[model samples]
Target: MKYNNQRPVVIGVTGGSGSGKTTVSRKIFNELSQNSILILQQDSYYNDQANMTMEQRANVNYDHPLAFDTDLLIEQLSQLLDYKAIEKPVYDYNLLTRGTETIHQEPREVIILEGILILDDARLRDLMDIKVFVDTDDDIRIIRRIQRDTQERGRSLDGIIEQYLNTVKPMYHQFVEPTKRYADIIVPEGGNNQVAIDLLTTKIRSILMQRGNDKIINNKDSTI
Candidate 1:
């Protein structure tokens, strides 16, 4: 399939775990042309732990920036920006390691990179045209985390609580929260912030339109 010749616009959405950044990303995505957009989750790039035992994997501090295979993520994202397809990695929450399957992703006009620690890395930040941080209270975040982990991730309530207290909470303060300063936009209520979502959607559409105009001009100049 043919891809847009113009470079893709990359939008980075980052916030603490359970801060509703995914929801915000989805809202922005749905508002735009779905055919021209792709959402890339940072969680999908978790470091491979195949060499480690289950016990070792389980003990890993996943909330930390060091837990991500950021080099691979940057490489794949750069490929996408260059209008190349990629075999994106799949992360298994249950196994605490990379999954056996790979997802085939095609290049798109717009890419939304969403994750808790996406903004923590300078290389990732440099790739983004727009940087957004979804700000939510810690109390609400923990509550959401408890519900999501228990229901979707098959995590025990005790384990979820322990992980939150031991790593997730502290790591958020140390790494995730600090990245908010890098954001061009800060949505206070995540997906619930309709105004912010609408504004972002409008901005992305404008960028896409500009790219389309540039492509048209380039094609005309080629004919001349």
Candidate 2:
């Protein structure tokens, strides 16, 4: 995975809901940032669901591919790939909208994009140098989702169950499940899979070394 100086490597990490994709992304980001890597989350590109009334939003399936502003994300990613400067959008979960905070990201030697639907869009899939899918069992995923929504997302048990049965499970079967075929690697058991995580870390290190970036530490200057 040695990257040319002129090109930026894009790594995509995707999985179904409650698959611990975020946790995997964080681990990879930490490992790669040792070589001056920058990470982005596709969750930041979720379309403004807050603006719509509860009725409108209620009918909306947040897990659907159409819920994200893929075009805008692609445009920004394009600029980054071309080594141009761009402002990345900041998404607010509480407001459920795109926020005012804009992060300026310059070209990095490596970029990691993590989300549940990163592989769903063809354009996004084309941009990835490496793509990974984290898989968890359906029942386990549902339980995890219930815990997360109830504790972190301020959702009731009944509401969480309703959403899971009504929207999440169906969407997983329709959209997320099919995209696993596109992954270069599939990680099972989520974060508990230490062997897979170690292998990934080793691969990332080897690639950075080949790129002559082994010494690129994440200091203030490197990020700039």
Candidate 3:
């Protein structure tokens, strides 16, 4: 049996809740599709809430790193890096449960993995070639999260505030903020940091272009 270390490039972006990791990931995905790209959101890997009753789920602390199934996530990511298709779990925040369904993703030249705790997990962090941390003020993040949850996730203002005050803020200080040291790039102000985003996009383009050129010479379908 043979193992392959040379796999698709992986980028990991992590940050505190509502720090704009998702926004950055989406932007990168949109910009990098010329050579095909797969985006995996760590939020989708949240542990299944099926075992818990509605009340239990309601009381669950989602900000904890343990709330996610990191082993499964790592396995799926490794498969993608090996040029294999993977069915990634889809977590529903509104229902506070992991659906039976998953999104089937094909291997691509680039894979962007974004989440709050991406850098916190040592095993997963080792997989990323480029690691980014979005740094935003806690007040700003909380405000954005409240708005996002209320509008997008169907959460009430009171509920959002309660969760942030009780679970999100403390967990961020404990687990997320300290992981900033691991980032190759630190993006401040989340999605509003255009300069940082552009720089990152350019870096990605250069890598893809270089690799694509080589692949083309080697008879690989180079679409970049």
Say which candidate scores most in TM-score.
1
Give the candidates in order of TM-score, highest first: 1, 3, 2
What does candidate 2's lDDT look like per residue over 1-224, in tens digits?
22356466677888888998888877777655556577788888988666687577567788999999999999999988887778888877666677878888877777888898999999999998888999999998998888888889898899888988999999999999899999999999887777888888777666766766655544322341
Per-candidate local distance difference test = 0.86, 0.81, 0.81
Candidate 1 structure, TM-score to reference: 0.93
Candidate 1, which segments miss by more than 4 Å at Cα? 213-224
Kindly indicate the candidate among 1 and 2 with the higher TM-score: 1
- Give candidate 3's TM-score: 0.90
Total backbone collisions, model 3: 0
In model 2, which range of ten residues has the least summed lDDT? 215-224
lDDT (tens digit, per residue) of candidate 1 on 1-224: 45556788889999998899999988877776434678999999999999999999989999998999999999999998998889999998878999999998877777899999999889999999999999999999999999998889888899989999999999999999999999999999778999999999888878877777333321211100
